[model samples]
Target: MKSILITTTALVGFAATAGAQEVNVVSWGGAYEKSQVEAYNKPFTEETGITVNMIAADNPATPLKAQVEANNVTGDVFDIEVSDAIRMCDEGALVEIDPADLPAAPDGTAAADDFIDGALQDCAVANIFWGTVIAYDTTKFEGQAPSTAADFFDLETYPGKRGLPKNPKRTLYLALIADGASPDEIYDLLGSDEGVQRAFDKLDTIKSDVVWWEAGAQPPQLLADGEVTMATGYNGRFFDAMVGEGKPFEIIWDGQYMDMDMFVIPKDAPNPEAAMEYLKFATDTQRLADQAKYIAYGPARQSSASLVGMYQDGKTEMAPHMPTNPDHLETAVMDDPEFWADHDAELSERFNAWLASS
Candidate 1:
């Protein structure tokens, strides 16, 4: 009887070990992914005994679309732009998520109420509000530094290659901003033929001096290499390069393009249960706020705002560096995911044609 009992206990232990899971998450690489690993993945595994596998992509949505089309869904969760989330959800490639299923705030506020507007969706939940803003090398300008959007395009004074992303989503908005358009009317203007042409016309001014960047990590590297003096890049990446690595860089918050990154599970994910569990764990108020310690992006949860504090260095405060800060938002262009979902392909074509033209 003693031997039989021991055998049974050993079998149960083996079964428990076999039940352990590893969730695969696709995300943008660099310091942003590091934040998730520290604040979400590590603690989640310690508490739940589930491992997390992070996969990097230029944009997670690209791999997600390929996996869905190929019918071999490997990644469990994808960290994608809100526009990509909206577009993918519309195509029925993503699973529907209920806000009620998410954990409520510590104060008993509902998740739906706690999250900022546009943070929750039927198929996605936002994690951070980041920005595409201007970053210039402080040592580049001796007397007067570039302070605004117009300064980015003034080649005569700045006199260095400008790093602009190779996408219309990021470039077009800046062109409009530099051309003296109001941030509130960016989307509306882009919707018209004249406005689209005007944006391209502004681009024509500095096309000869533009050094195009395709990845989030490239802008900083371009600036560091002296390939570009002023560049448009993710605020978090620039923050990491500046504060974390002690790069001689400074961010010009003028005309930032703000957008949220949402976490979504595909319908046929390899580990649906684990994916959902990780998603719920990672987007809670505390986790969202904790991420602020590593990156300057704002937490998506309203309750998380008060919880945010000093940076990971334990010295620098994270608030003023955040893209959502009031001073930074004065000229910020808020991303319209719905508008991008509808117009991305069309505008991308035009942008490509202009880039290819003389």
Candidate 2:
């Protein structure tokens, strides 16, 4: 009888601790993080009493990879790009997620069927669809504003410092677009040495005037500080700076690279159960749609589209600002996760070497 009482007491204590557990989530910072905090994290904490701790990353994939490799996983959940999610899953770094465990849509459709095609994988569940596009300071361009991808590389025409990310995945595509490679031909051309050489050559044209940025927040800061007249950055970040902060910025949607952001749990997450619980709660139709209130990125779920309306400011319509808006899709570049999953290593090495030279 004494042993049974002690065992019951221990079980009750464990339940109390579990109810108060915290899950660490790593995601891209700036407006994106703020959106998640408002839309997902706070509500989740209120409902479950599980505290959600956010950690920002330039790209969450970088730190996720490091943590998995070192066998020291600290974060419970990570928001990463589709390509990175695939790569990490293949490497056995992520925990497999079953679609059946996810919440069903309001119409009673199963999660696997309700989610958009390619939104769900064995190891990740997509939350949002975002893009990288060129944004320029409106105050700097008095006469004519830059509109197309070609204009981004036309140094003499819109002469001033240009801001670009310090990574190949984002930079190379823009270079190819400016070099006249159609969206359909970008991957094919990038498949060859000469094609890559062409991209590098194009980038070299404005190398001296480039201001490289690593984090999403840096581009808007660069433009605001007058360090660069224009920059290539996440469209959502630019939207936040323009609408939320009232920065004089205009996004050029031509040749924007669209990608999905997904949530993945590392293999040895500190709080695996809470991570899974948070992942499902955060990616639901309502939560995904609510995110649009704080940022311009589109929700990955089809049902979530109708729910997305105005921004937090209440008056500004968010449809025109979204990366997936019909008007912005004309020359959009869909991210090829399979290609990047296959060739990222080789291309990254070559890109790093090129960055070192001249």
Candidate 3:
């Protein structure tokens, strides 16, 4: 009887402590973070009375992996790309996320059936379907604006510095697109050595005029600063600059690289219960749709699509800007997490060697 009383009291005390602790969510900074804060964080705190701390990183997975390996995990939740989520989960670094634990759609659908294909994973729940699209300074092109992927490589016609992500996964597909590889053939082509060489040769054409950006925020800044006239960047960041800040930029939807951003909790997170609560609350249909108002990222839930409407400014319609729109999907390159999972390391190594040679 004495031991049972002590054990119950200790459990109660631990529960109270966990309730008081904040959930530190690490994610990509800039306008993307701002959108999550506005749509998910603020309301979550209001209802749960738990203070949610948001930390920004160029890629949240970097710090997440470092913290886990060092056994000093600071973040309770991390928003990462699907490829990283899969890689980390396979390494036993993330907590398994069971779909049964998630809230179902408002219309009485199960979460397993409600989420879009590939949005839910073994250890992560995807929140957004985002795109890596090209954005150009409208002022720079006074005539015959760049409308297609092929135009990105037509330096003779466009005649300006191109801003590309330093990473190979993002750049290689665009190179293939500009070189006339069909969207359906991207992954199969990338799997071959000859295809990789073809991509490298295509990249070599504009190697002199390329300005490489590592962070999601840099592409918009590079274009805004006049450092690069045409740049590839997140569609939402470009949306924020064009609509929110009124920057003179226009997005080229052709051959956009569509990818999803997922939310995962580390196995050894500082506050596991609260972290789970935040994950559940923030990924429901309503919250997913709410995110669309702040950024152009498409909601991962099919039910959320009907709920998405005007942008946060209250005047601008958001349908046309979403990368998941049928019109936009026609030429877009959908993400294949398995391909990147198998080839990310080798391609990255070759990409670095090629970069050095240039």
TM-score of each: 0.95, 0.94, 0.95
Name the better of 2 and 3 by lDDT. Answer: 3
lDDT per residue, candidate 3, 1-358, as tens digits?
3433443354355446666667899999899998999999987776666788999999998999899999999999999999999999999999999998887788768789999999999999999999999999999987789998889999999989999999999999999999999999999989999999999999999999999999999999999999988999999999999999999999999999999999999998988888987898789888899999999999999999999999989999999999999999988999999899999999999999999994
Off by over 4 Å in 1: 1-18
Q: Residue-wise lDDT of candidate 1 within 44-124, one digit each (tens)?
A: 777667789999999899999999999999999999999999989999999999998887777778899999999999899
Clashing pairs in 1: none
Q: What does candidate 3 score on TM?
A: 0.95
**lDDT (Cα) of model 3:** 0.91
lDDT by residue for model 2 (1-358), tens: 3433443354345446677799999998778999999999997776667889999988899899898888899999999999999988998899999998887777767789989899999999999999999999999887988999899998888989999998888889889999889998989988999989999999999999999999889999999999999999999989888998899999999999999999999998999988887898898888899999999999988888999999999999999988889999988889999999998999999988988988
Better of 1 and 2 by TM-score: 1
Off by over 4 Å in 2: 1-17
What are the Cα lDDT values of the candidates? 0.91, 0.89, 0.91
